[model samples]
Target: MAIDRATAALLGGALGDALGMPTQLLTPEEIDRTYGFVDRFVAPSDDHPVSRGLPAGAITDDTEQTLLLGRVLLESGAVFDHRRWVDALVSWEREVKARGSYDLLGPSTKRALDAINAGASPEDAGRGGDTNGAAMRIAPVGIVMPFEPLEALVAKVAETCSATHNTPIAIATASAVAAAVSCGVAGGNWREAVDCAEHAALRGANLGDGSARADVARLIRDARDLVRGRPEAEAIPLIVERIGTGVAAAESVPAAFAVLELAAGDPWRAAVVGANLGGDTDTIGAIAAGMAGACAGMASLPAGRIAELKGLDVEAVRLLAAELVAARFDRPDGRVAA
Candidate 1:
């Protein structure tokens, strides 16, 4: 049976994460010299900074955290549970250490969790977080919620980001990704999803610390326009240089949207191009491919590639998707089935 949008979103993020694992953190020239084109899964280079020693098709913290958030949501229902969320992060980090993976927690997440562990209030823990960590793992929030009444969705996004990324820029960027995923789960087309994302970013910017400099809505619009009719060869470099492919939420989130637009919502193509986009490649790929998969469904992904994904629980993803769909219907406004 074909998987649903929620499953596609989670799985696609993992697929993109794995696809970009080897190429992440390298310069574009380094990527070209090392892998030429990252059209298939490959083991991380021996000297890779973050993903070394991982086998081909192994996912990184991006997908692992996405699923972790999904599980938290499942256990807590639609309501936000800050304590459970923090505990899960702490436990997950311990488990990752036990496995001896260097991928550990992201900088923003680590700092916030550390503060929380030091007895800082949850509200204050993430106040300084400004990275793309929240956006990178936001797919599940989009999956479990509906896109309509976008303010509500943005509120949920804010709640999700509060534990590790409460800054305005972070919330805005994550809200954009979540809105796009929610739109896709609602069966909206790519254009509609992008539109929703922009609007959500605008709304999200109004929350959190309002003084942050970045304008995520305008950034996403510019990123999309920058690559409108350009070929992949031209657009990819343009995005890497102009919008950037860094760990900053302002950069990676917009870069992901730009890749989605450039690929015209082709999930596999989005994964491929995102993987080759250099710095923070896995995150950009995860966000872009998650959006593409949300709109196009699992059938849009290559079957062989899907089968090759390592350490991901396909059955668990499907079950979460089903439960999320049920939760959406449980909402008062839910009408059509997802």
Candidate 2:
């Protein structure tokens, strides 16, 4: 049986998040010294008390936040429901606080959610945030609304992102990611997906000098050119530096795309290449992995990488994926189409 698109996206994202958790901070050299290339997901570092060396398969805030947003979307069934989004954020904050999880909430998300709880307008809540939280949890939107009109999908992404990231660049990056994922789900070729993403991003925010969109686009083109005949090990470093692995959407998004483009046939390698890039590895890996996973499906993912996601809520990911597929492809007849 063919795996549904939504499940494919969710599982892909979760697996990437889990696999990159342990190597989130280490640079290529540090990762090599500490974990040595990280082919298989392993437990977190013993030095980090909070994570307490979380087992190999443990996921981080990336997956958790994405899943939470997916639930909100599934529950609401309407695009851009502010009340539902507020409730979801509140509930997520409470859950994380109750669990004593420190890193589960992004700074921008926390600030915006706090502002919303304090009676700030949703439009104003995220004005101070210029972070990538909006981009990180946006994959589900792509999965659910893949075939919707571009204007509608872009509007939904803007509405959702405005709660924690209203900056022009942030909005652009988020829209680009959602559009790219949607293109992938729609079975467009990689070049087509990238083109859609570029157009969507340009519509949302101009690609100014030093902007994330410009940087990511440059990286994508360069990586594609460099990887034509080079081995992954040689090409990955160049891509990472050009694109970066920082929290900025420009850095992370492009880096993720580079991994996907370079490792087109291997989802596992794509994710690891993202993780080993050092800063913000988990988010980068998560974003890249989501796209790669959607394009390649579960079968293309390595057994070792899938095995590493052991403790993650796989069933939840699967359920979210199924729901997104239903929302995107399934009509009343119970069949999926483009």
Candidate 3:
């Protein structure tokens, strides 16, 4: 039997995280000098900030935060409890510190936490955030809300996004990623999935409580276009050239889509190319890998990388899949057509 969407998506993301951890902040030149086109997961350097001294296959904050959202999804069932979920993130960071791990929290999230500590409400805590953190863990939201009406999906996704990174672009970006995952689970082809994602993102852009540039949607569209018809080897520099791989939702989210387009929905290649993309690799890799894996299922994922995954909650993901499948809200019967 094939690996289910949940398992494939989560494990695929973990593979990307492990593969990218060693080169998290380095330039392509630095990465090439240290490992020469890394084909395998390697241990992080002690000088590394977040993942130092970890085992070869250890995952980082990307996978860990994904798991945190997975747990929140399981605990809350189909409801999007904004307060509980954000609180759990703060708690998760504390746990990371308690364990003596140095996996850094992103700027938007750290600011939100500081806001909360300063007596701001969770709902108010992330009003100013505009980073990729909101999009990073949003796969769980899409998993449970599969098949919902497009408007409703976008609205709910934006509401969830409000817990952190609440700018219009941030909300739209997360919705796009989640929308793609939902489309993939419904068995849509890659182009169809991407098209659906753009629609959801556009719809989501109007629903958030935060401020954002009016041109963000156009920027994302431009970034997404860079991957179409381009050779995989040429796509990365072009992506870095224009799309960027920074922490801002606009930069990182579009970079993720470029990977998806480059891979043509191949989970393994998406992960590999994402790892080599040279900035914000793990999150971008996870975003693309999750969408690709959801569409391809476990059987189509690269066997070698899946075998190399370590420290992932494989059993938990399997269990979560059963619940998400049962809770699926909506999908047209002809979902493959987008």
Encode model 3's per-residue lDDT on 129-230: one tens digit a residue. Answer: 788887877876666665457866676677676767777778888888888887877777667778778887877788666555544456657776877888
Rank list by lDDT: 1, 3, 2
User: Best-fitting candidate, measured by TM-score?
Assistant: 1
Off by over 4 Å in 1: 1-3, 102-104, 333-338
Looking at model 2, the pairs that clash are: 6-321, 7-321, 57-308, 212-250
Consecutive 10-residue window with the lowest summed lDDT within model 2: 207-216
Alpha-carbon shift of residue 112 in model 1 (angstroms): 0.9
lDDT per residue as tens, model 2, 245-272: 7776766776777777777635567677
Question: How should the candidates be ordered by TM-score, best one leading?
Answer: 1, 3, 2
| lDDT values, one for every candidate | 0.86, 0.70, 0.75
Residue pairs clashing in model 1 are: none
Tens-digit lDDT track for model 1 on 1-338? Answer: 12387788888888899999899989889998988888999998899887888889989899999988877876776577888999999898888888887354678998987798799988889887889999999987787778787777888889888978998899999999999999999898788999999999999898886486577889999999999999999999999899999898989999999999999998889999999999999999999999989988978888799889888877887887777777667766532222
Question: Which ten residues in a row are the worst by lDDT in model 3?
Answer: 329-338
RMSD vs true structure, all candidates:
2.4, 3.9, 3.7
